[model samples]
Target: MTDDTTIEIEEVGGHRVDADRLRDLLTENARIREIFADSDVAGLRVLGPQVPVRDQDGPPFTATVVDATGNVAATVRGDLDRPDAFEVASTAVVPNPTHEELRGALEVLHADERYAPFAGRDDVIVYQPMPPTSDVEQDDGTVVRRITLGIFDPDGSPVHRFVAVDLRDRLVDWDLHGVEHLDDHDCEDHLPVGVGGLPGGDTGLGQVRVRVVKGGQELWSFTVVRPRDSAPTHLGKGSGVELRQVRYRGRLVLWQAHVPILNVLYDDGVTYRDWQNSETQFQAVGSDPVGPGWRVCSGPPATILESGTDVGNFQGVAFWYDDGELQIVSEMQAGWYRYISEWRLRDDGTIQPRFGFAGTRNPRTCMRHQHHVYWRLDFDIEGAGRDIIEQRGLILPGQPVWHRIVRETKRIRSPFAREWRVLDADSGRGYRITPGAADSSADAYGVADLWFLRYRGTELDDGVGVVGGPPSATQVKLDQYLTGESIDRTDVVVWYAGHFLHDEEHPSPHQGHVVGPELRPVRW
Candidate 1:
């Protein structure tokens, strides 16, 4: 080991030179070394320290280094703040390989005999950092990172193979389909085994697990079950929507396409709901082996005609119209019931949440029932503190329907029957929850539109029924949070309930029906 106190300087070309010391200094500082290496520079030569005595607590020292051609390369600055610190800072251009270069490299890799089967086939190749796992242990202090190139067939079949690279060692590993482990020491041997699919049958969907690793430690992991149909649902070919984690307006915005809770009450005194909790009865999206019934829909974006003015379109914009709608559909009761849940993200930062039931009615004739769908929105608005809820109601005068927006806002200290808004004072951003389209008849509680309550971590007992349990249960945990606790400038949760009544007179459409609320942003 080189002593930190020793300073070596070699006079080269009549100029004091210390190339080895400069390289050692650059390598000791991780950030500066990364910049130097990434810049594709050949080598660096230290000219000399700015000060004669090499003061330990003096200002930063500047040294000039020459590139491979012996020409002046860069002027590096080193801060001698600590006796053992050799921190270097420099301005160097680290040019990343272009997409064409990456594609060319993939083409060359596909030419290998191991990847020949996937060559010349229309495929989707995704590159991502492999997470940390026990399979690859890094004991040498060399930061071991892996990048995975997942290759999928043209029809969006399962990932054909995972081509990985050990960045630190510059080694390559490939797991090809139908091939056993090529090497006994392969990382595949130590990879974590994920749940294949539904316990009993194939769901036509496949699972892909990726781990995000940093410094040989797993930081995060994600598992994505391949959809039966890869195309967007709005195209009408499928109903599976890909919910992406996005950062909107400097805030992390994530969405879940399906909410497991769906309650169906029949007029014949039977209720069906707890499918999510039932191990034997729970069916995943593509569980139906024969002609997978579940589908996701990315509905065509429609123009928002609010207040008779054509606001910017919802979903995403194109040339003429916008594209919207994120939907998922799954069947239960052996195709007797098809449940469709949809979430539409608008360009205006509003979310339109809706779900409905369709498919053939049950064998029981004259089946009149109501479907209540509840959503659990765990909002961490502006970092999740000091949030308040307010209810707004329209006060209509006698025979006078105010054309203008006539609504009252009140702090919700307890469970309230009105439209609500969750506001964050720090960010000045708020969300208003309103009911979707509903029938003229009033609900069982007379307030079918929405409900407001504080957040109790354990509100849902076992995910048996909706958040509020059955109507008969006295302690409806959903309303239990509304114990008159002041929700003013406090962390709270607002639960919105929406229902659709299916009667013998008018049945659900052959396709299905959609109903839910529009979550609009207030002063965001």
Candidate 2:
């Protein structure tokens, strides 16, 4: 006999006997002696056991047996020493099963009496089994395979049972039932995308790259660095501020640029506050913040302007509109007062930024106060270099009816109103920064309508403070950046300040009020 020709026994009673143990048992059994008496079965080697093929209606303990000479002896379908029931047979070959056939056999085991409790139930969903383990190769080049699957129910939502299959021999290794539930977080790996309880698409623009923690969100950076061949790229260092609603005195307060307003309309007949039948309704462009560290309103395309000219039934020129707006609001003292700020992106590519102090006054403290609003604008027109500031305004000479236009092209050493424009000749794009509509005391603090300075690292002020108070140290540093760097063509930033004086004696009307500045593009 060849070394490869060996005897193999199939498992019975869901358990396999050790090869040495089975050999000893067979040698001592009288029934095996009767079966192999006519054959030369001495000095035979033993091979590993094969898993038994389950019969549909046979007794549960039945299994097939083979002799030491690799010959099928007989079917063991009784409670004998398992190997004793084998009678001599002619065939010796048993083919290995495929993965699919093994999986089907395991399913049968799942429906059998062993796993009858979980055989059928509602509200129990079964996920597909994971990929099989890596193939285990034998010396003869045959492969062994195994796979495991979890059974889950809704309560506690953990997997308590598992099905393990031995695919090579086409047998169910174990149908584990009533075992201790293990936290199978790995089961979520099998879930379909967007169907599992995962966060979908709740991100904002300028947030392409961010480090997020649960519960709160922050603004890490606002600048996007795109490098030119000869110019050094601007590396974006985050502003180091929280981007979501702020906590002021234990209440959540949103900045002006963080409030989301759907639309701002100026219709022919309706007022700007009218929500119904307004001619112009602006749209938001996702959830990107309008300014640094603040959320802005975005949706629907803006209806910037509309006009038509007709000559006796023949229409002439027609104008439609497209633009954007950012509106934010903050409530103080339980809605007793609401501070609102509105910024408009004009159709002609200019920005109209403004703010207002309105709402009812608290009866407890009807003291007089004023609101000073300021804005910090960083201009990057035509690659940030060689820009000149020009102040041009119409001045009346000593009460004469005729007004003389004064135009001065120079750096702003001090703060004053002159209808300033920061122009870059190379790009031919400039911005005309001026104060918007105000109540009365817009320039009460002697600050200019606009201030210009070279771009510096830590100079930012929004001008929100007490009316008659001194400027903070930050404001003083802003002045220091303007000591006189040649702004003729270098990178620059503009600071525009506006204000509203509110006295309790002259309270705001039920409708409220608005204020700020208007910035228009010059020679773009």
Candidate 3:
């Protein structure tokens, strides 16, 4: 018989037995025989009592019993031994049952409501993203440490795998799960790019090489290093790599030269697979942060203007002398356009745009600054039952400026629930403005405006103002005027309110609300 063969045969205590050609004795064909405890058949097999009796090569496993004609009848093992031990030892000797069959049997025998647990739990599953961190040295003392981002379970257990690439050697190592084993010979050279750099530098760029392999065959390849001063190359044999700094929201990041034909940005940590790239187009997904922490907000990558033509997002705005023209852009987009009612002066003798829109008809105000000048315009609006007001102010960063009223409106909307204190931008202090009454029953409301100036080479001053003196009685507490219970990033403005007192026969107009100081932008 072969080592890997299974056949039906006789067995006594798991030993093969062959007694077919011998005698027709009842005990000879018995693969398994049993004698009950203190019973009539206890000493029937006197050779060794409970010991199994059979030929060396046993017949097919079967119980034996003597009949009147001496013909041995093959009974089941259950007929000899008790059901418990017979089932256990026989189960161990046979092939394992199918999983489905075993499960079905378990379900039939142990039918309890709470027998199978974990049937309805779902909150235990969780997914989370990995955050990048600063670099450190590896234990080998040669390779530098890098932060690898990946998903994990809520209990800090790994859910996905990530590859760690060596920036210097251009090696890719796979991190596997379960088995704590390292397989270098079992790895394949699939990619050849890595992220490397110190935190701070002039040119925020890194170096990397891309290997081109076709079906285990080597193709043409190139290596390029990006530095702030030099230009990129076609291969490792270039004049070194040059890179530019990209700053966004005061954070520095590595800038990739946009290839117009491909419209793709390539970095050391980035690969073709990471981006959706075709023959003529490509799109970048939110992958990872690399290079210097700074993001470029100007030049070829981002066209942000300061004092001439406005072209930038909300994070930052700037303008430079491309040829000889001036431009102006702001982080705050113009949301309204109206007539200016008032204007304020800065500490540098520069004029700042501060005013009210066209209600109650405030006059236009103007200011002159060292680098730029501004003019405020206000319109008059008075109807029999209501008065309308509009205001706007314009600033020319340099000499001549093209003014575009990006925003013009008569209604004010805020996302917070707090009474903002209007601060004076020039004085680096807040204004002492009297808050208006929030009377929903009377349909009374208030409005105000604020303006700011950006000095050529300085930051705005930060300060707070104190409210005191005779106006204290008319002034309402900051909490009283709030429309909601929470406030954040809300603008403080000037407000005015009024109510009529009557005895159902008489009428009188009282000074509902009074103004104190104007709201303007100061240093942050």
* TM-scores, all models, native as reference: 0.41, 0.35, 0.15
Candidate 3, superposed: residue stretches over 4 Å from native: 1-129, 133-136, 139-143, 147-160, 176-524
Off by over 4 Å in 1: 1-247, 252-260, 276-335, 395-418, 439-442, 445-449, 460-477, 508-512
What C-alpha lDDT do the candidate models reach, one value each? 0.37, 0.33, 0.20
lDDT string, candidate 2, 1-524, tens digits: 11222111111122343545555655665665565565444432333232221233233232234432222243333333565554433322222222343345456556556556655665343322221122244696444444444344445234324555554355554543322222333211122111011111112222211221112322111121100100000010111111221222122111111111111111111101100000111222333222322222232222111111000111101111222222222111111222333344332445555454443212211344444444555565554455666665555566432222222112222333346666665765677766554623333232434456665433332212111112331122234445655665666666655545555457664223456556676665
Candidate 2 ranges with C-alpha deviation above 4 Å: 1-337, 359-365, 395-416, 439-448, 462-477, 508-512
Which scores greater on lDDT, model 2 or model 3?
2
Question: What global local distance difference test value does model 3 have?
Answer: 0.20
> Which prediction has more favorable TM-score, 2 or 3?
2
RMSD of 2: 33.4
Candidate 3 Cα deviation (angstroms), residue 219 = 61
What's the lDDT for residue 230 in model 2?
5
TM-score of 2: 0.35
**Evaluated with TM-score, which candidate comes out highest?**
1
How many backbone clashes does every candidate have?
13, 15, 66
Error of 2 at 158 (Å): 58
Residue 200 deviation, candidate 1, in Å? 5.9
lDDT tens readout by residue for model 3, 1-524: 12222111111122223323112232332232332212223222111001121122122233222211111122222213223323211110111111232233233322334323322334221111111211234575322322222221223223223333233243333442221212212111111111111111233233333222333432212222222111211000111121122111122211221110000011111101000010010111111123331221233222111112122222211221122111111111110011111112222212122211110100101111000011111100110111111222243356332221112122222222112222222332322222233221111111212221111110101100111112222122222333331211112212222221212123212222111122222231
Error of 3 at 482 (Å): 30
